[model samples]
Target: MKRWCALTKKKTVLLYLDRGGGAVGVCGGLFTATQKGQKAPETAEGAEARFTRWLQSEQLFSIILSSMSDLQEALAHRGSSPPSVISAARSGLSRLLDHLLDQSAGSFSGGASEWLKLGLSGRALDLKALVSALQQHFLLFSQRLHSAEVERRSLRLEVTNLRRGLQQGVPSDHFLSVCEELHQALSREQEAQTLIQDQSKQVRTLSHSTQELSQARKEVARKERSLRILGKHLSGVQKEKQQLEERLQRAEEGQRDLSRRHECVVNCLKSAETSCKQLCHACISRIGWLEQEVSAHRSHVTALRSELQDACLRDNQAFVPVEEFPEPFPPADPETPKPVPLS
Candidate 1:
């Protein structure tokens, strides 16, 4: 009797099992409970907890399979309601299978094959295993999709930052051109300063030389004045020497006349002394007077000789040495006189 009851429980459990693409509706109440509870919750964590609860409830199919294995023991103690109970069990099993198949069919779309390639396939040997596998696949797929979206957003933000940096950087060629212009300007400034310094040095040297030239001109002017004074004095001395030379020549001529007269008187006295021995005394007195005049002229001639000698000595001392002039008078004669030449 236990064996018969066991065989009937097995048949009831088999009625709820999912064939490929089939419906099962016994677990529909649990999905309804989750949907109603999710209406007030807004956060991802709350939604995840609800989904976990739903998966756990779906695992109750395994417990139902175990209960069916003990149905034989339960049927043995029953009185007379076996047929009615078996009918109710069969109806409940049918409803459960119908609900599961309906839910699976609702999840499928025209692109169901593509979804399966992306690891969304839902195939299992039993209802419990199928629910567990589907739950795990859904959780992992949702997590991977969210992570991929976050990574794409981060990459876009980094690209924007790099573009801004490029806009702010300076151009290399323009900076180099500015540096070259500054260097050229500095070089020109240095050259101008050097030229100014050289000009200043040359001006100083020329000023010093000009000062020395002015001093030399003053000395030359002073020497010219001294020479003019000396020239005037020399002219005066020359005129005086000329006059003295004239006077000396005249005196020399007078002395020659006197000597000539004395000689004539001596010749006449010699001729008279012989011829007038017993002659008159008057003749003798006239001869004596002639001798007196001759003596006086001799004294005058001696004085004039001394004056000429003195003038010659002064000329030697005062005049510049030069060739002497020739004497201007002849020798004295007793009876004749010669004229003297003036200088």
Candidate 2:
């Protein structure tokens, strides 16, 4: 039997020829009918693209139908006001196209083919009737879209004229008055800002002065503390001076006592010298008597020797200076010559 292949809008459908000379059921379950033997391999990406295209076509058909219904309703309510309805329909179409594009970019893994197969199962669907309805609605939608473009242009022209009127409509006097008021308000605001800046500067200056005062106060406190320390040192120095004065007074008293002792020793030496001179004179007189009588001198010499010993002991024992002795000794008289002391 001769086998042939046919492609359709939905998918690839496999048709087999039966031995009974009749067409059998389709394989692969695609919308496109083709011979079953030695089928070409369908790539995953190609299948996904086909599915996406089919979905977008169906969505376009639905959008056309919806737009037609809206147009019919709008025409019934407001006889010739088709611009609003047409714009609404255009917006809906745009959204539908966006949705279809999104679905085309989404995941199309292993199970997408199964979903396509299920979608192709008709269950009493009339594709021809759907195509006819889509054609009629699409024509109506196109005509309305053109009319809407014309109306949009007219609306843009009216808006431009209204803008021009607003720009050049007011009196020059009113505009000048508004400008003058704005200038006055701006001048007042600038003055207020200048005053605020001046006040802030004054506050900062005052704060700096306060800091300087605090530093001066601290210096004063430090000086006062130094003065207190100096006072304490001065008191200590005064006490040291008093102690030195007392030591000086005691040293002066000791010097005076040493002077009195020295004077006593000097006077004792002078009195002993006078006594020795007297003894020497007595010895010389005795020597002359002894020469005159040699036998008689022996007894006299013994008595004279005993008297000299007693005189010498008495002079040695004396420790006091003469109270009657003058400070400046009297000179010896020429009539009564003083005796020279023995060596």
Task: Please estimate how well model 2 matches the true structure, expressed as its whole-model Cα lDDT.
Answer: 0.59
Q: Write the per-residue lDDT of candidate 1 for residues 8-65, one digit (tens) a residue.
A: 4344332333332332322211111123323332344554566668667845566455
Using all chains and alpha carbons, the TM-scores for the candidates as numbered come to: 0.23, 0.34
- Pairs of colliding residues, candidate 2: 13-32
lDDT of 2 by residue, 14-99 (tens): 54433222222233332332335534556456766775797578666776566466555665775556676776566555545434
Q: Which ten residues in a row have the lowest lDDT in candidate 2?
A: 1-10
lDDT comparing candidate 1 with the true structure: 0.55
Query: What stretches of model 1 exceed 4 Å from their correct place?
Result: 1-191, 245-343
> In model 2, how large is the Cα lDDT of residue 120?
41
The TM-score of candidate 1 is: 0.23
Model 1 poorest 10 in a row by lDDT? 25-34
Local error of candidate 1 at residue 72 (angstroms):
99
